[model samples]
Target: MSELVEHVDERDRVLGVVERGEAERQHWPHRIATTICRDRAGRILVLRRSETHSRFPGYYDVMVGGAVDGGESYEEAAARELSEELGVREPVRFMFKFLCREGTSPVWFGVHEAVVTEPLIPDPGEIAWQGWLTEAELCEVVDQRLFVPGGRKALRRYLESGSGSGAGELGAE
Candidate 1:
């Protein structure tokens, strides 16, 4: 399916409409996206992007993520992505938001983390590789630039804050 996207100013207010490709190419107004991080036992789930992706192909990143639909809240978008990408429907706890201006398209991104005790059933087309990593090991991977730049920053901030709790400002009802 083609991506549905909108251009927005630095404050995340809509400025105009643009095809996803044009927005990325021109770094038009910022867009909204979300990342989901899941922990199981003492390890976190991470995945390598399919080499076919338009951006950051072959890079390892947080378990699940995608662009938020117009008018969808970050939590809603995150939960939808979790289920679509991993076939997991567990509740997601809010982490934080990260602004990524380094990409072809600047983005206002939300970060979420969840704990999963059940086995994951990931979509092969969406993920090239998947594995569990300890927190320290994950940080090492981040240091080595394994994850998308914005993802790395969000993960670091989440870890440093020591709050596994949700932000409370937004939640799935």
Candidate 2:
């Protein structure tokens, strides 16, 4: 089935809806929900995309996310993606939202957070591997440009949002 994705404007107001594949192929503006999963120890879970996937395959990603389907709110999409991709069913607290464009691709990036309280059974077909890393560890790799473009952008925005304090500092985060 072709997934329907919400297309939004610069202000994040939905302009219309389009097929997910076409949205990607044409770089249409869409809404996506990203969750930065953490555990009690404050380590964040990262996933490596399956090599067979079409976009950024085999790249590391600190955010587990996906398109906001037509008729779905960002919160709904966020929770759904966490369960589908990482087997997380805990309550997720929304952190913030922003609109960004990289080259032609654009997204209303909704950032969320949650302390993962259950075992994550990643779908092998979508995730090649998964690991937990500290903010410092993630920052090191992100500085090296070792993450998917969206992940890098999202993480940078997250760090900036806290002004490198609060939850932004790596080792102390």
Candidate 3:
């Protein structure tokens, strides 16, 4: 079972601890993660969550992401999630960190960006569909409300930066 770290208010102050299941049921604020995957052409990868997920099921989101463990750093969680969800073996660079509070529970969100030069194998349980889009197309989705609220915010930040820093810093080719 997944474990969750608890927090307080919209600011994400630490409260106490709770099990992942309990936290989900109780709507406790916790840390959420997001990763941006860029192809050699600078297109970004996005995916649709499996319909089986309890929250935001079947919604389009970042390439890979998840909740952070109790003592995990944002960068570690982002890197771990990338490998876990997409079978990516390259190192992930840190980008921006933001908080998303649109849900019943607030989320301390970390945005990371990575450039992929190899093949990707997405986790079926976490991803139902995947595709690459230009910045304009991605922004259009955000405008049309195609992504979850937190994802929208994260994407906007990424686009505005003109860098995938929301995902991470790109390495030299």
Off by over 4 Å in 1: 164-173
Which consecutive 10 residues in model 1 have the weakest lDDT in total?
A: 164-173
Clashing pairs in 1: none
| Clash count, predicted structure 1 | 0
Off by over 4 Å in 3: 6-13, 164-173
lDDT of 2: 0.79
Selected candidate, larger lDDT, 1 vs 3 = 3
Leading candidate by lDDT: 2
Per-residue C-alpha lDDT of model 2 across residues 1-173, encoded as one tens digit per residue: 89899877788888888997787778778998989888888787888899986667888888888889898888889999999988779787788887767623888889888789799899887899998987777777765655776677777777767723335543321
All models: lDDT?
Answer: 0.70, 0.79, 0.74
Q: How accurate locally is residue 66 in candidate 3, as Cα lDDT from 0 to 100?
A: 84
Models 1 onward score TM values of 0.83, 0.88, 0.84
